[model samples]
Target: MNFIESELLRIFVGEQEKLHHRPLYELLVSEALERGMAGATVFRGLLSFGLRHKVHTSKIFELAGELPMVIEIVDITEKIEEFLPVVEALLRDSGAQSLVTREAVRQWTT
Candidate 1:
């Protein structure tokens, strides 16, 4: 398979975080799809932590809803860069963390 150089944007937020009463992750994915992004994925982490230094995990029964969630979007450099401002705005009121990195990726079709 052939791979193309691209940008990978990862957004870190809690499962319980919301924007205008809707789940943050869901809103982000919807926005990415609407913007015609290459692809976006949301992962539910079993265990994780952030700048708060508090461990969030799904292992504990009471901590279920507060588990960490990661949303990853990968696409061409220009597309990713253009979409970054929208993402920043989305996280502005919510205070979520985002990370971007350069990577090589390939899309496959059957």
Candidate 2:
């Protein structure tokens, strides 16, 4: 069995101002990858709400507006640790929070 030791970094940030969620997430992932991080991805919640009383969830068919987005990146301990500072700076600049970072013991890949 193959194994990977890494940290799973999950960052939840608000969708506000001119900073679009998808683009921001892509940028973050790209930046991390460029720094030699394993990989990163962004996940958009269909119906979700977050800080600043921003409500992206709605029953109507029409799209409301900005929604909470999560950027997940997994990499080795050294790499993830190196990325933490950068991630923090980005989050601070964007005024976003709810960052959850933890060490992952195993990775199951086919």
Candidate 3:
């Protein structure tokens, strides 16, 4: 068993205009990075759908296209908290409906 100290924040989002796709997530991730967050990760799901109910999954090369993504970041709790305002603003700016979840750190490791 591996043990590490970290805080986790999850930003779950739905589909929107293409312009808002990665940039919004990027902005938040960048802010975290700038603040010296331990690490941040953006995950583009292979087969996923969102509030639109349009079944973003596909059988071809575009399988990952238009799919909802889960933007996750991990760092110290204080750092993550500091970036909350900007993160909230990004969510508002993108007009993206999202679920924000956080939990105390026990053990997190890859």
Top-TM-score candidate index = 1
Q: Candidate 2, residues 69-100: lDDT per residue as tens digits?
A: 67888887888888888877766666655556
Instruction: Provide the overall lDDT of each model, using Cα atoms, as 2-decimal numbers.
Output: 0.81, 0.69, 0.71
Give one digit per residue, the lDDT tens place, for model 3 in 13-38. Answer: 64342234465667777877887877
**Model 1, span 48-86: residue lDDT tens:** 777777887788888898887788998888898888888
Candidate 2, TM-score vs. the true structure? Answer: 0.74
Instruction: List ranges where model 3 is wrong by over 4 Å.
Output: 1-5, 14-22, 60-64, 106-110
- Evaluate model 2: give its lDDT: 0.69
Candidate 1 lDDT (Cα, whole model)? 0.81
Better of 1 and 2 by lDDT: 1
Stronger candidate by lDDT (2 vs 3)? 3
What are the RMSDs of all candidates, in order?
2.2, 3.3, 3.6
Best by lDDT: 1
Ranking by TM-score: 1, 2, 3
Please give the range of 10 consecutive residues that has the lowest summed lDDT in model 1.
100-109
Clashes of each: 0, 0, 0
